[model samples]
Target: MKQNIGRCEFSQFPNLSKTICQEDDISNYVQHLNDLSSDFETRFEDVLTMVIPQLIINPYGDIEETDVILQAELIGISTN
Candidate 1:
């Protein structure tokens, strides 16, 4: 999330910052947030692809959808 924010094109947000928030700019801001959220979702899915295979290969493999989700959360937290 930090990296996504860092990669934002600040020039596109001329009136937005810590000190100022323009009501007119609200739509643009929302669009940016939506795009960033989509990007992060795609990245997380990629992370799952890399992690799920290994989980399935475990000696006592008993992986479920919920297990994949939990593992993905741990992997995301650990990397950050």
Candidate 2:
């Protein structure tokens, strides 16, 4: 199985003062949020594809191994 983790960072302007600051730009902020959500979805799909197969093998020979594969298949449908 392959393990890959990615991190993203963004600057936040949480301390904007009304007297010294301008009003927030709604259009730009919405675009940024959409972009971030898309990036996260892409990264999650990549990791899920790698991890699900290894989890199905059940090296310890547990009976619940079958259930894991079923659940992974269901998750794959939604992710794809």
Candidate 3:
């Protein structure tokens, strides 16, 4: 997937070290977060594709029909 997005060359970080650690720092952080979000979205799409066959065969795997319950059962995440 990273290769699909092209090679991530080790470029130098921008002049973020000079910025005051406040709201402005958020812009830089948000860029990194966006990259991470994109990566996760790509990976999740792959996983969803792999799981679709099981979902079609299993009665309990209807995430498409019931997102709330399905997410709770499949995602095992802790907001805290």
Candidate 4:
């Protein structure tokens, strides 16, 4: 599993402040799994499923509550 954790800034999305703070809890959970001899890939996949949906997609999609809306993730733009 890749240990390279990327950086993310939540200053622009204050609603995500608590979500960002939850990363520490995720890290500790993963560490606990590791100590139990869990595979890195398994741990990463588990954490990703829990964190990504709850923190990024769900919260951002609730437009009535948050302003930081994520439409899509793309590498480049094109027209056909």
Candidate 5:
């Protein structure tokens, strides 16, 4: 996305003419993405605090033994 945005002219930016911000296209786009990421992090703070299972993120990586309940959840994931 960044590479594609970098290839575009500032004049070609979406809503570039409408936005009141004084920043350049690249800076504005970066700030927009940063804001989106922050919003997602705030929205999913509970999921973040849940300590996502490592194997769910990386199937090939080593993982410590988890409780039976979590292991059941992992099995459910693997089955799908």
Candidate 6:
């Protein structure tokens, strides 16, 4: 989406974008999106360090999840 922006000219821009926010220039809108993406990456930098359990992602996966506490947590998550 970020890569394909402005590569092709739209006959009429999407009405949702226009209705949501006021941007007179397409270039500015593109720039805004770029900034937003950058901001999101910056804010979620800590998420990169997070070691997510494979069992949480795929319960039926052939993963040797040995931690009992983690298994309990997974059960709690599933129950919720």
Clashes of each: 0, 0, 0, 0, 0, 0
| TM per prediction | 0.32, 0.31, 0.34, 0.22, 0.39, 0.52
Candidate with the greatest TM-score versus the true structure = 6
Q: What does the lDDT come to for candidate 6?
A: 0.63
Q: Encode model 5's per-residue lDDT on 1-80: one tens digit a residue.
A: 54445445446567753555533856787778778989999999998889776666786343246665666666666678
Query: What are the lDDT figures for the candidates, one per model?
Result: 0.56, 0.47, 0.53, 0.46, 0.65, 0.63
Quote the positional error of residue 14 for candidate 5 in Å: 18
Worst 10 residues of 4 by lDDT: 71-80
Off by over 4 Å in 1: 1-20, 48-80
Pairs that collide, model 6: none
| Model 3 lDDT tens row, 1-80 | 32312223223434533434454545555667679988988989877667555645764654555556566765443232
In model 6, the Cα lDDT at residue 38 comes to 94
Better TM-score candidate (3, 4): 3
Better of 1 and 4 by TM-score: 1
lDDT of 3 at 40: 87
**Is 2 or 5 the stronger prediction by TM-score?**
5
In angstroms, give how far residue 41 of model 2 lies from its true place.
Answer: 0.9
Query: Residue 21 of model 3: what lDDT?
Result: 49
Could you give candidate 6's per-residue lDDT for residues 1-80 as a string of tens digits? Answer: 64445443433557544443433455676888899989988999899778887775787554246476666666666577
Per-residue lDDT tens digits for candidate 2, residues 1-80, read 00101111122333432224222544455567778878988989877667555445653343354476566665665467
Model 2 scores a TM of 0.31
Task: Evaluate residue 52 in candidate 3 and report its C-alpha lDDT on the 0 to 100 scale.
Answer: 59
lDDT minimum window of 10 residues, candidate 6? 15-24
